[model samples]
Target: MHVKYLIIGAGPTGLGAAHRLTELGEHSVLVLERNPYAGGLAASFRDAAGFTWDIGGHVVFSHYTYFDNLVDALLGGEYLEHMRIARVRIAERWVPYPFQNNIRHLPPDMQWECVQALLPGHRREVAPTNFAEWFEYVFGAGIAKYFMRPYNFKVWATPAEMMSYQWIGERVSVVNLEMVLRNLVLQLDNVSWGPNNLFRFPQQGGTGEIFTRLAARLGDKVRLNTPVAAVDPASRAVHTADGQTITYDKLLTTGPLDILIRDQIGAGPAAAMVGDGMRAAAGQLARNGVYVAGVGVNGTRDDDTCWMYFPESNAPFYRLTNFHNYSPRNAARPGHQRALMAETSWSDHKPEQLDTLMDKTIEGLVNTSMLHPDETARIASRWSIAVDYGYPVPTPGRDDALRCIQPWLEAHGIYSRGRFGGWKYEAANMDHSVMQGVEWAGRMVLGEEETTYKL
Candidate 1:
């Protein structure tokens, strides 16, 4: 009924925070989770046919030594190391991961169009006002049209003009005219541009294995099937759906910041504590939903590709991963079976009919050359999961909103840090999410300044 530190949502951020707090000799900690299991969006599922699938395509490629050490200690030798083999599907051809860097792989006319648009003075010289302008300013009209614009719209489910460009960081591979021309002329493939070129995965379970092990270490410190209905900042108490009230000295919430501020807090007497500016800021935050469809077949393909991006509408899904390649155990039969996982995003800007998504996804696989028409009969299993909070959109007003909301929460002993809680796509990766929690714990216990996430 009481604790020194209380965490909501036993996802990576909450688990990381509790784990770090324990490491700091703080055991009076409790993690409350709404789901029956752990891992949050990073969770995995096993289908009736014995196929393993993640919520979406998640690969373990970290930017922090702390995360690396933690993963190593947890998984030990149970994980498999992999070199990322990412690609893009354009004009019925497989271009390397960075579509702009590998325009040479496109058709002759398309390649020339891209090269012509990148010629001197072809790009805008003015400062970009939004993601749309930013891409055109940096990549020109041809590349933006063929890849950046369409693919981003597909994945984010938001118009480029409505989103901010500050989150680009290392997520996008920026290239110049000279570099593009050199690669085009030299027939070179710039596959090794991003940090995820070398990654790791669980050899047995899906990406959720790491978090499952972490929650196990925390033992009974984590409570599953417990969803918080409201947070009373006045009394520093969390009311669960089942009518139990848990009081805490400090609170770290890993749920959607918008829901926490606008719905949960607004529902109670603490509503008066949240100012109009904070509520308006919460309205500015946006997110997209994702539909993950896993198709298991009786036969296997010998492709070495890890995942492929689809900018064209030929496929209903924006991305597809060869799940079987991540680990042989992911499929029912190691060598004879195949598992293809497709991810389709939706939001107010983009809507999808869920009932027919599976059929469309399979048709997409055939259209994208992942499957044949006759092979549809060989399909043994079809599994799908829909998550409402997929990617957090980095709108133009995100930073300003965070400035208005985060400080107020921190002042009230509430620290929200994670993908949806922080609402920062750039820092929402697995490593960054864990480090945000680790940094928050460090700040709480040792008075160290938080570094991974800053307003």
Candidate 2:
């Protein structure tokens, strides 16, 4: 089989690329997806008990107009727009999102602790060298100690010291002492701080509906259940596990960049072509695993909050989403049930007992006030999935490593993109992932410069 553009993994990136290619009057594009369905990590699944769950917590929010239009065209009137009501569970209180800006909600003593740490002389004046230092440098010791450090550790599953602070773009809300004090003194809530303050969700099918619709538009161009076994960049061909060799003029792989380089390319006949430096750079790339557990209860609550973050050890999960709130159809009984989805991250630095994770997640719900202790028996369904590649850790070496590896892959007419493929958490949002593909297609066909996943 031969194609002008062959994409691996029919996730948002692959589908976006193929769709754009077809839009640009290119018909020889093909997409290969390992899963039986599309959407990749953004995919949703309906459990046997009839509760819908996303891979993690994914909301439809974008930074680009092209992405906005594509989503509007794909989902149309089938989506629900929402004002983000995010919160953080800290010090036995529900502090508003951007915990640093809402410390006034904390206990008097704890509020003073946060304020004292932000005092002129208390904050370090030295330049930050890593994520941990950056937290202290930007948020001061109190906010960093109470929220930034622990919460980041729980989410990334790697010590902040081992990661870089460069990826902190709009993903983090940076606050100065003045803004913090103003909010604290006036008792203002800074909930509308980030890009996702206003987002969208499909009325049904969780987040995967957009991709399902997109893959449908591509027709036979997308091949499901086709996992790539090896890639011979020298020959510009991909060997699938089904024993089919597909050659491509240009290849876009949306799989993990490390696995694509190390397991596929480096282990294939073109191993010598990869060289030692790229392989080592591939090894330097790090990512944590995420376990998503959906707990469906027999009754719904009146809470309007969207999601809550957990930084304390009392909860096994780092974040919990009110899945039922995103779309009532997410629950089996709609208005009568609650779908509580929790996410826990794991890596070598932080090992979790997956076998007991579901139980731990349920216990976490009770600890975080998401569920009543007695409501445990009303649990109708418990569905869980663990993805090995979750958020790609932005280690200090990431940029240098990408500098070393991406150019070589591009030299071989291969573009590895998306969340894990690009290995950039900042650009790993649904919009960014899709736009990365759209930009890749634009660059290939229109000679346009790719902007989303720049090295």
Candidate 3:
């Protein structure tokens, strides 16, 4: 069958692109997906208790008005907007978020320990081109040495030294030396600019609901379970895993760029360059995540908080959230029966054994006192899924490699955009990812500038 565009991966990004195309009256579009459902990583799994768990924690925070406007256009009803009440869990202590900026909240000795080597004057003197250097420059030696460095390793499964700091643009805020010192003297919390400062979430369903509903708006354009197996760029034909071939004038690939290149264009100096970009990225990545481990405790209180982060090495999970508090339906019950969701991460190559990691995660919560070890709470069903490229690794030489690969793909008329598609962590949030699709459709049909793809 002939189509104007063939969009692969029925995730939010692809759906966004398709919706835009449909809205603009572009009918010759085919959206394909391997999964039976849309939403990709934004998809959620529900347990028998009516509790919904996002593949990973996704909050709708957008820098682009197009994304914000489109989501509102598709979405109806009251979406919850919560001020961020996040904290960092380190060394069994709950330090307010932007841990480096607020570590003064810790015990005096702990504060002194972090401040001693981090006098702002004696910080690392190197040029600090890598992530570790940037960490030292932003947080100083003590905080970086103690929390920022090790905790990141536990998450990305890579060392900071190997990472590049370019991707931290909007994802992480640089520490304020003056404010940090001032706050150290007087106990105070710091609020800073970040993408998800005040964000929205569905009132009932999880983030997946947004995508599913968005897909519904597309009518019959999406073809689920349509995994693209191969593509012949010469004739612009895509082969599905089921041995069906579809020809299109243009193709948008949301799968991993390196894999798509190797499969479609074959390996060579060009393929090696793309692969090197991925490897260079891996050196910086602390990839993989384990989530949806909850505790059903008795009695519910109004001690509502959004999400908490962990910077200490002792804590296995880097983040925790009071799910019930985010939306009562997240936990879906009241009274003393409380449920909490925490997330931990690992790497693909060196994954922590499922059973072993689960044990450690629970113990970690107990050890941290977030959950009392002695308290009896039935361990409800746990949800664990390994997102291969959960967080894109931004390392040095990445731009060089993307520069080489992107143009080559463009020459072949193939557009790759998304979280993993572009390998941009800063612009890889739910909203940004959706905008990537929307903007790509604009480029395809309207010949307008590529917005999300620009960065």
Cα lDDT computed for each candidate against the true fold = 0.93, 0.93, 0.72
Candidate 1 lDDT: 0.93
What TM value does model 2 have?
0.99
Candidate 2 worst ten-residue window by lDDT:
183-192
**Model 1: per-residue lDDT, tens digit, 49-108?**
999999999999988999999999999979888899999998888999888888989999
For all predictions, the C-alpha RMSD in Å is 0.9, 0.9, 3.2
List model 2 lDDT by residue over 272-364, tens digit each. 888889988999999999999999999877899899999999999999999988999999999999999999999999999999999999988
Q: Provide the lDDT at 110 for model 1.
A: 93
Runs off by more than 4 Å, candidate 3: 264-302, 334-337, 348-350
Error of 2 at 132 (Å): 0.7
